[model samples]
Target: MNKSSGPDKNRMDVKKLVSIGIAFTLFFIAQGNILTVTDGGYSPSPKLCSTLKLVPILSLLCVVILVFVLIKMLKHKYVHFKNRELDSKTGSNGLSSMQKDNERKRPAGAKNKTIGMGTDVIKLFQQMKDDISEENTLTLGYRHLLDLACEHLDFSAGVIFIIDHNGCISLRGYSGIIPNSQENYTLELKGIVSELFERNMPRFIRDINSIPGNCQELFYGFKAAWLLPLMPQGFPVGLLIFFHKDVPKHREEYYPKLDFVNIAACWFYENHRNNRIVACENRKIEMLIKTSLAISSSLSLDDVCRILVSDIGKSFGCSYSYLLLSRGRQKEMYVQQCYSERKTPVFEPEEKIIDIENMTWLKEIIAFETPVLLGSEEIKGYPQKDKDILKISGSAGVLIAPLKHNKRLVGILVLVEQRSAERARMGKEVLDLCTALIAQASAAIENARLYSSLSDKVAQLTTMVNVGKALNSDLTLLSFFERVLDGISRNFKIQNCAILLRDFEKDELYVVSVIGHYQEDALNKRFKIGKEGITGRAAALKKTINVDDVSKDDMFIPSTGNTGSEMAIPVILNGEVVGVLDVESEDKYAFSKREEILLSSLMNQVAVAMEKIKLKQLDKERANKLSLTNTLVKKLSGTLDQSDLLANAV
Candidate 1:
């Protein structure tokens, strides 16, 4: 029936052919009685017997040929069947092997696809790495990152936000059509961003309507958004947001691709952070250099203060800045200089003396020798005086940095932040910078003060030396006094000056020499020591007395015209006050410590010169008396009259 059964039918046909040949030989032998040949050895059956033998031989010949043909046909059929069976088995095995091969190749194809994706990611990373290396500024780096992200990730628009020290995010860089009102958008999304940042995960919003109604407008034209938190050191330092106007094809691919983008964003954040640190350090160095130059360029305290305040204000972008310097032995603080952005009048009254000890915050700052930052809200709770001061400054935030030199508080630097939100976020970095700047400025200020003091002292000594030279020359007592008075009036710029000599026997002070508008009235004036005016007081006490306002001073007896200020220095020789040097002025607070010291020095020279003049007068008078005695004795000896000699001696 089938090809596989064809070999069996062929074998049956061969057997039938053998059987028919044998039957033909048997019939012919029976008909001709060829088997009777055994008995016909004696009797011959002539033509029939011969014909039967011939028939038997012919049948045998036919049977042999048929058998040969059958054998050949059977062999050929067997070979064909064996070949067909082998082919059939081979075909079946081939089918199964092909299926197994396909199964084996499927995973290889997937592996190749995965490898290709990985290769692309690696290439992108390399590209970004190059960008990081080439970019010199943080802005440029951020821009490059945004551009790369949009190009590779199929983002229509993107924005990058950096977190400030106060944990507020502000837009730093962007690409594509970011609206100008993005600040409002950012504010609205701050809550969502905070949650996502806290979770440290990326979020994909597929539907714009899913967002809050108020925030939905931010993504009006965008069909989707990918919010990727840029976490460095497991803390959110920034965020990278990508938006799409329409859903991207092969959207499933974006999920895996986002991993690469996340890695890239982290790199970008790290790079930007490093750049900011370097830039900040550079800025600090530059500011220090400029400040040093500005401070050193001038020797005047006013100039130094102005430069310091201006430089600090510009550096920090502050609205107001001022410097408070400590003065007097009591260490009272005073506002030395002030600067403000607004032209409005000051809100608080000016204070001539600041009681720093009464202000707890200022005392703390000085005691700790550290800076203090105050907010407007906290300032409201402070003392009334301090509260008024801050309110007058119009500051939302304030920084007070103490200026110290050699462990002593020299001054305080006050910076006021009015409108800048950026300045309000000053952290440790800003504090450190301010500390360094203040340290340098303090040193400069201290040096300037020391130099000015030394210069004044030198000038005073020079003046004293010149006065000594003039007084030591050959001059009479009256001439010497007049020269000293002239020198004092010229050098000190005092219009009213007088020298009062102590009359020890009378226990009183009398004006020996006077040079002023009331010279005639004051020259012979007399007053009791230890009981009268400033001059008497100085002689009795053997010290200097300075009066800022002679009219207000109880010890002042204003006799030398309407004197407003006065200074009296006692002239001492051999530990005893011999006289008093008195100088007066028509202006209040006219005498400084330096002037007082200089006057005392000049008075010492005058006292020494006066003592020398007195000794010279005594020598001249003795010589005249000795010469008179010798002349009288010579005249008496020549006359030889005892009575006359006695009269001359008497």
Candidate 2:
């Protein structure tokens, strides 16, 4: 051991010697001091007894000193442990009473607005963790954080100014400014906030004069101002500005609490931002999965289209949606599938035909054919009448993503809705959904093409059967036409029905039948095949027209019982249109898929009946001639009169 350690050793030696001396003296006393005497049996003298008592008292005093030393060692151990945790936990190893008292008494703001700054400081950090857990988006994280600060702190007003990639400070949200007024201050708040953020540090100013003139003069005038870096390294992500009457001026006594709060602030932004990013990634994965499922699970084109549009809209929170497709060889765009939200939905007809240019958004969407997005300004371009309709239908903005697939533009989709900032963020998911719908639409078109070809073969077979029946049965032309017309019209759900057949000898088409809610013009009107009127026109062109709105259709002639919609299908025999089956409806686009097939069926029957009737007339003529010739032969054999035989033939 070193010489310096000797004093401590000597002190230990003295204590050991004192203990031995005290023990020896006690033993000597107990053995009895050499005295005897009176009433008690052989007791030591008072002097010896007093010496023993003194030893025990001194020993007890020494024990007390050892205990004091042990206590000191234990206290030193406790202090060491507390120092580490306090520094890491609070960033401040020691805090003065006044600082702690002030923190407890006041959080962030005035009495009425108790920011519960302490509570909020903790909550904000907690919120950062939750946001990171969701992994939705940094923007969302910023919103929640700003809200928590403004709400918990009793500041008169507050704002979160964010530093963008361009190193510019931009005001994101404000609790005090009217929502409408937010735009005015966005650019104005940029300069100073940006400079402060560039400094990459925290600053608290009680009055404007405390700050350097140019940098914080404007900020200082705001009563109390606090700026905290969103990130630790000084590249600012965001900053909070508080205007509060309750906050005491920042001073040395209050620095520790400030230190803790600032540390928490930076952590809040970083963690929350990271969480949002993760959430965004997860959402993208989910959408990809859903898109794949929709394409595989649905079979029919219409079903797939409906599913694609609706799921995307709901998943993305869009209020209204529908699909538009090109129809016929002319590529006329019309509404194919339509749906809307339960709370708010689009109300346009399922079959809207667009022609010319700029008639409405429907036409504009077709023109662009790309994803055309529209907000209030774009939607306002609609006609005053349409605008009124749009308002009632809860549409102020819209986005139309064309169902473009396979390099062959298939269709367009219209999504109309109203939304808030938060709600709009939710809508990004819907945008992706539009891409999935494009594939489903192409499959649908192919399916439709197959169904059309199959329906044609059925029509041909049906025509042959109907012709045989008409020739075999001797029903009057009017009665036969009525049964055929009614069957076709009723099946197609046509509100009005009329048939015009060609007159071979007259070289004209005349009304062969009419069955409807409205009366016909004397029921005997006739016209050349290529003349005016829908029936005549159909015969002229040998085509079909399924017009949704008769009033809007130039081909339609005015009639009674509100003829809002109409269709004309030509009946052909021997590669020529012999007649036309005309139908009308009080409702626009009344012909669904099932209804259209019914019209074709009725037209098939008419074509067959016409062919059968013509054949029967020839057969009857042949039979009559045969009978005349037989009778003449019998007469001639008996009378030998050639002139009589000829007369008999007639």
Candidate 3:
């Protein structure tokens, strides 16, 4: 080949041509021993053979060159072999045991068949990471994932085991028929099972019955189990185990598909562990919100308890929840209002409940001043005759939390589990959440009760002063009625109100005082007892009347705006009905039992005031009658001095 033979070619070409030409020449040159040189005769002058070197020098030089060439060739072979191996292994599953010609030679990290993770799984993992770092509401991130596993793996139940405060990792959810399954399926941190938890990787047991060591406890009922470690930020929080349906033989071909499930389950478990932390933190923030709202929005103990318990359940995913109060060191807790999904309270005690100090369950929770989680076994041992009587009631699990306010335990919060393990599993996270919620709820309950007691005292004093003021507010019929109406209306906004006076001789009810929008009609109408309208019915029957829905009332008149509720009162003077006072509301059922009592008292006052005015009228009429009688007597005597008599009479 024609090549550029300048300075670059000169060094390399000279070395290559000399070595190759001499190597072949040495192969052809074979000679026998000749004459002596420097000893006694003619000498050949000690020069190298063919200007290369002396025989001894040449042999040594050729050996050195050959070693160099061999080392270089070996190095080249090693580099190529290593590159091929690396190429095969970069992203592929296992080392290819196939033919050399069939060996893959793609670049390192190139797409390979064993690559299962794509953009979807990567994005999902990224989202899981974000959820770990931030706040989240749902702690069970793999709830939906478990559903997928159920569909794909053909298994019924699965569970995630986490270390508790006591360093015990217990089984939560399970599937299949197993003997004493509830009792035996548990993970202890210090023992054999927990050693695997520390390892934090995928551990598969193909046949549990044939394991090397004493795995009879864990694998007793289980035939095949796959336990995958859930690494939250690369640290093991727990292990997830899935038991196969019936039994299965571990096949190599099944490993690939099983590997996919393991990868997915691992990611979900990681997300769930992170979410548990995030969920707890979010609940803490929610507790702050509920605490602030419970204090500021209202001091209603009932309303505060409602808000507190709801916030707690939302944060903690507690099973059964309630707020309890002891009320001044009574030792026994009074269950105020339990938060649950019930239309009405399932249990309503007619009398206050008393707590037994000697109760085994209450000993540590109440006296020791520590929260407790009574496991399924403890709950089963609890002797509950009352529950037996209920027939369908059982204490699923008990989370006994003390309620503290102003550094004092005023109450006990009992969270009772309602749903089964299929729906939710109660864990240590739930208990911690309840403790925090109780702390916030107790503060609110204490404050609200104090506020209510104070408010009751102030209201009692105010009513005494206002009733006397009502008696002297006005004198005339309409003016006095307006003052009375104003007092009642101060607390309630009514659409229309009227005063009706019974004209007994004519047997008619006269509309005297009216307020609100339908002033024209209320002023226009007059009725006798037993008339068609609601007001007349009250007068006819002589009873206080309350109508919840005016729409249902057959004689309800459509007034200005919409009328929804109505009320009427009978005014009794001298133990006989003299008039009626009627009130109407646009609000449906605006008047409650308390309002009904107060309004009746106002009507009684109106009767007394009106009766006082009637007596004064009677006294004036009697005096006029006596004056006319005197004039009649003067005329009847028939006296001759009529002018003098008329002057006397005047």
Candidate 4:
């Protein structure tokens, strides 16, 4: 019977005994060999034998020490190898488990089970992390992710559906054999996808017959089904659908793992969506920068408008876009520039100008300080004129961005989207993002408008200076008036212009000077004051009158039928109306207030010239009479005769 010693103690004892035996064997062999080689069987002396005995004992002791050292070294190596094996099997938790085992003895089977489950969970997480980390997984869609989940969970078929913020669900990926149909093209808000998302939980179905009719075909020949909602944010953005041919034996144990997969899938899906959103936002920002550049490219309002319409139309995917500018505090606006994706015009040339008073929708848009987005149903409630315009433009949805500056509404940007089953309606996010863009555009447009107005003022001043020079120069009264007409026709960019002088004694206005394509009879045309043409009205009222559309103005009597717009200003001298300056254009609304002011200033120069000519004629007549009187007196004195004097007097 051996006393119980630990493995190390027992091994040390065994090595000691073995080393003693080997030492004894080696000593005997050395002695026997020496005896055989010694003087042929000669008897040894007592001293020699004693020496031999002592040497053998010394040799045996040395051999036992060496062998014991070697055995100890080998034992240390074996212990180290066993420690490494234990560490490998138990991982970092080995020491802790040992402590726990000493504290309270538990069944080894339970401990092994716990460790195995933990290892499996770690491996599952690691595998999912590796799969999602791949770059292609994001771009190629999440089909691989679904496939991984199916493979791990032993599911036969699986599908994934992603939901947007608008409650719109779309099929992201599908694996395994699943029936397809037109109804499955896109999952609507009221379908199983929505139901699963709203439930926000994992559901396990034992029977396949319990599924909805439309979705039952998808899991045909399947015995069991499972649904998992991917709700990383407490609200579901995705759903996972899986079908099994046979019920899993470890279904209970698989739940937590399945939930983990759900979480991982959700994380991957959200990251993918977030990346796309960021990309989309980046594109929108780039568009805004480009639009700002376009607006800053020019100071001309027309050029700015043209660039804006095109950029906005293309960027926002609009079917038609119009840049409508207000008429300076008036409830009126006109399309400064328009764009059509279909290469068709939205409004005719004559219909470019719009009266906001008649269109309630325009007025509403002008009243708001921000952009407004309207759907087709909401647009139906707008005014008839607005509806007609939208219909003609083929607009199913409308986005109106108010362009405001200095706290005043300068204009509105109208973006029209056509109806299409494949296209998506504009979202509110568009309006939110566009708010800043609209604000920047408004400031730029305001600056452009100011630049345009200043240019017009400078031009008007130049025309006034030129007209004054032409009227004051050494030209006859008739030539001076002709020069006035010519200056006006050129400076104002009008095709038709005339000067009409009122006959004080006849109470009639007659054309004095004319330019442009006037009828042959226009030169002598006459109108009764206070009752006839635009000129007569200006003369009678002694004020300026502007008609945007001559065809709509009853007071407009045309000298040439080509005139579509007309402006008349009275020419006054010493507070009395003496004549009228009439300007006309072939395009409707062609005459603006600036033109009226310019023409009026030119007419003042005309009045001054008339007065100067009248005074000059009077002075000449006086000089001629005086000269005749002097001649008569000289003749009478030379004649020294009463008859001669009397004839001169007569």
Candidate 5:
């Protein structure tokens, strides 16, 4: 049995060995076959075949080594791949953790950046506030504010507009590259500006195309614009506008600064408003002071009027300024003094008279003692002549301020061709100022008139006193008449004056003394009472006669061809017309009221002196008759005897 087991184990070993040998053999055969195929089955010697058989074995060994090397490469590749995957997972986890950390820190970083930006904005505001605080004038303040805003906000252009109470807008200040059309931008409140003013809201326009077509022209060349209303005490006073030439990328960044911008705008508005008020008040005070000084400096009405017109033209920037004095019983206003800017046409003819009787507005102005503003639109209501005058003068508007004194209209102060917007802005203020000025001017004018009248009256009284003294110094009637005529001509500034004496016996009026024109021939010229000229008429009617234009009067007897005006005042004494004093001039209406009173007063003294002379002459004549009769009676007694004379008389 041991021998049989041993044999079986040996058989098993032999079979495993046989399997190995067979596999080896098969591999060699295959390799030989491959070699044969590769070598194209080329035969060689037996010795070469034997050497070639070792080639197959060597080839099999090389293939086995190559396979082993390939397996090792695959294992290395798989290990490398697995390690790479593990590394990828670890890297992904690290990245996630880093991302979470970053997310947590982001809010803090953002907060810090926001605080820094806010600080920068505050610093900018403080800088701007410091910059504009030094300005005192409204115009300068506006300029500074606009300039600073443009510089700080990267704006291309800016403008500030002030709206008056009358809904008129004026360009107050501007900065950078303003359009030429906007240089004199003045208009009534209208359009987008007006709408903004009415609504009192801020408007930010990112797209200019969004603007209305009608107002787009105002924002030409601008890509974005902001219009901020300047409201003080809830009243729209002005607008602050900024223009951007380019669209900003981060517009939100600027949104936070809008509040800062608004604060700056409010600062500008308050400062400008205060400055304007101060300036206006200062101007008013200065004007009042200057006017008062002028009024007090002179008693000459002409000088006062000149100062007033000059001041008005300078202060109000009027094209023409003038004063018109009321004249004649017709209440006509005559141009007294005038001042005009360069090349401005005269509004009214020099010394032209404007009748207030037909001008209801003028009458209202005088009656109410207020100013009347007349624009070209309202000028149609004026008289044709006045309308023509205003048109010729190129007046856009005329402000008429009445000069009233003691409840009477003394004169009018007219300012012509004021700018319409400026007029709307300052009309009431100017009117108030002018009203005060007119009050002072009226008083001055009235005082001057009184002074002139008093001076004339005093001179006339002096002349009459001198004449009376001379007449009472035993002067003859003819000498007295000549002296009276000379005094009338010299004192009354009359060129033609005559004294006509009544001849009661002849029932005629005879010129006793004549001063101007055919003086010698006029002397002692007689006219039938109640049938002849002005002197005769005066005597017949026992009243004074004044003809403004003798050419138009049928009763005027031309003493001279140049006599356009004449006055005949009757001298009455003891209830009867004694004589007439006649005066004439080449100028129509030359006899003023003062002259009439002077002549009347002079005639009164003359009449009294003449009456006394007539009485003295009558007494002398009676004495002469008595003496002649006595002498004749004595001569008759001497020649024949008292008895014979008595018998003849009986």
Candidate 6:
């Protein structure tokens, strides 16, 4: 029943054995030694021999020989079956039928070489499919694969370069003796190399010197090489190069034999690549969640700026991150926050003030309120200042995201990619990935700004109420003016403040009271209305005026050299200019529209209070005169002397 037993031999052997069994049965019958069947039961023959002497000696000898012959034949058949079964089970050590036929004809040691090569290939694939642990990174796995490949193909050395999804080619692994002169590691798909990848086949270089100069260095110590493009799904993901010190005798034979190895390498690399992509995506999701939490945790502008720069720089793996904000209606931007991944940062936080006029690219982004990507080509068209800033970071690409809400540009976020071919290729992809994050950040930043502005408005209203109380309080003219100046300085945090009243009869403006660092000449300083200082101009025009930079204003008459900015508001009474309220600061553009409104309202109350105090002084003066006149008339009437009365009148 063994599968390996030959059918013809088994049939012939079975017939011979059957014929022998019949002969033996006939002999037993003739001697009456066999049992006979009866109606009721089997009975032994009455004439059965009791001793061997009764039988013929020749027959006994024949019987013995037949038994021995049967035993020998059976043993021989058993041996044949076992040998055939072994042959079928092991498949003659994986040799094909043709190989087995010609194997005997082949010369000595050829079979052994073939067998060894097969064993090595099997071992290589087994090791390639082995589980990768945490300690065995993808790069290490590639190196191990390269080593196994070199051993299997009988190559001296090998290296692997992988082309990632970003279209960047990078060296992943190397094995065996790398030459000392091979310092350049950068590899690219160029000319024949590119064509090799496109063909998706293995190439053999008979002479290393025959290849391009850029690739010849890779085979410095080698005479020839095998270039295999590891393609998993009909597209090359990696390139494997095997170096040989001597040119292969059968160069064409070697390339065809790489089919199995190429398949295994491609599968291994593609699987690892997919895993890495999934892990990266998961990381991005985690970063997005964390950044969202950080952004929502604060309503302060400063805090938001800090979180934005820090989180974005870390999340995107950028060289630098910057937050720039537009102040008021100016066409300028100031760096609110900066984060750098480099050990030595190039720019400090709030250290840069950018003029939008000079940077047309930034100006376009602000105007359009859209994100922009600046690659080398785009950067070339930009201004020198912009180029210099980018150069400082060693960046080859830039992403500028506008932070806006309701069509208003509140600020912009800048992300810089360092000078790496891989990073430069990733710019567009990174921009796409960060689009959602930028949108979320924009909304959050806008909300934070609004909250901050609301808080400022509330504080301004509180200051206005307190200042109005001081202005309306019952006090003498000098005391009233002093209290007004004191309230203005304390509530508004102004370093300098003064009330300059117009002397209409003299067509001049004179300082009534001053607060904080005013020069002695400024205490009672007078100006010709309509032709003099900022305060006088405001009084003449009966309007509010703000000089962001006092030094730049032609009509600015400095109370102190330290004042960088000034604001003047005219206090009006009964449609007439009563006085001007002037505020100064050492910082330019220190005042906003809210501050102007608050001060203007307080000035109105000051005008009303001044009028009330002036009325009270006039009534007291008239009463004193009336009382003195009455006392004089009473003395004259009682004395009845015309001369005394005339003298009193005089």
Off by over 4 Å in 3: 1-184, 187-192, 198-236, 240-264, 314-320, 327-329, 349-360, 368-371, 385-393, 467-650
Comparison by TM-score, 2 against 3, better one: 2
Highest TM-score among the candidates is held by which one? 4
220: Cα error in model 6, Å: 6.8
Better of 5 and 6 by lDDT: 6
Better of 2 and 4 by lDDT: 4
Q: In candidate 6, what are the lDDT values of residues 1-650, reduced to their tens digit?
A: 21212344446656787798699878877766775567887676655545345569757866876676677568656655654564454332232222233234333443334323544554455555563322234567778777777776688898877775446565667888653442435456676678776665567776666544354565678887887776665666677888888877855445323644564565566566676567567756876786677566656777877887887677667878788787775477777778888856655322465666666666777675666776544565666676675343335678888877677777888887765543343344456566666667777787777777786666566656654565456567878788778776776678899888888899888987888998988867899888999988898889999888787899999887698889999999999997898899988777766688778877887788788788878877899889879989898769988888878766
Quote each prediction's TM-score. 0.47, 0.57, 0.47, 0.58, 0.54, 0.57
Can you write out model 2's per-residue Cα lDDT over 489-542, one digit (the tens) per residue? 433345677778778787677776677666557266777766666766777788
Each prediction's RMSD over C-alphas, in Å, is 23.5, 14.2, 14.6, 15.7, 26.2, 13.8
Model 4 agreement with the true structure over 1-650: per-residue lDDT tens digits: 22222355456777787898789767755666323344676444444565577787788886887687667667656654654574464232123222232223322232223233554565665577557756443424467766777777678888776664445455657778654633433355554545655656567778765643345566678888787767765666666778888887655554545555665675566666676577558857886786677556656777777777787677667788888888875577778889998989788766877776776656667677888877655666666666775343335578888888887887788888875412534555566666767888787788788878787777677766765676456566677778777766675667888888888899999888898888999987999998998888888888999887888878787778788888889999999999888888888778776677767876776688788876766777899889889988899768888887878766
lDDT of 1 by residue, 271-324 (tens): 656776786798699879977875666476667787787767766667778888
Q: List the residue pairs that clash in candidate 3.
A: 48-53, 320-415, 320-416, 332-355
lDDT ranking of the models: 4, 6, 1, 5, 3, 2
Give lDDT per model, in order.
0.68, 0.57, 0.58, 0.69, 0.67, 0.69
Clashing pairs in 5: none
Clash totals in order: 0, 8, 4, 0, 0, 0
For candidate 3, the lDDT comes to 0.58
Clashing pairs in 1: none
| Per-residue lDDT over 473-530 for candidate 5, one digit per residue giving the tens place of the 0 to 100 score | 7677778888888877777678988888889999899887787885456765788888
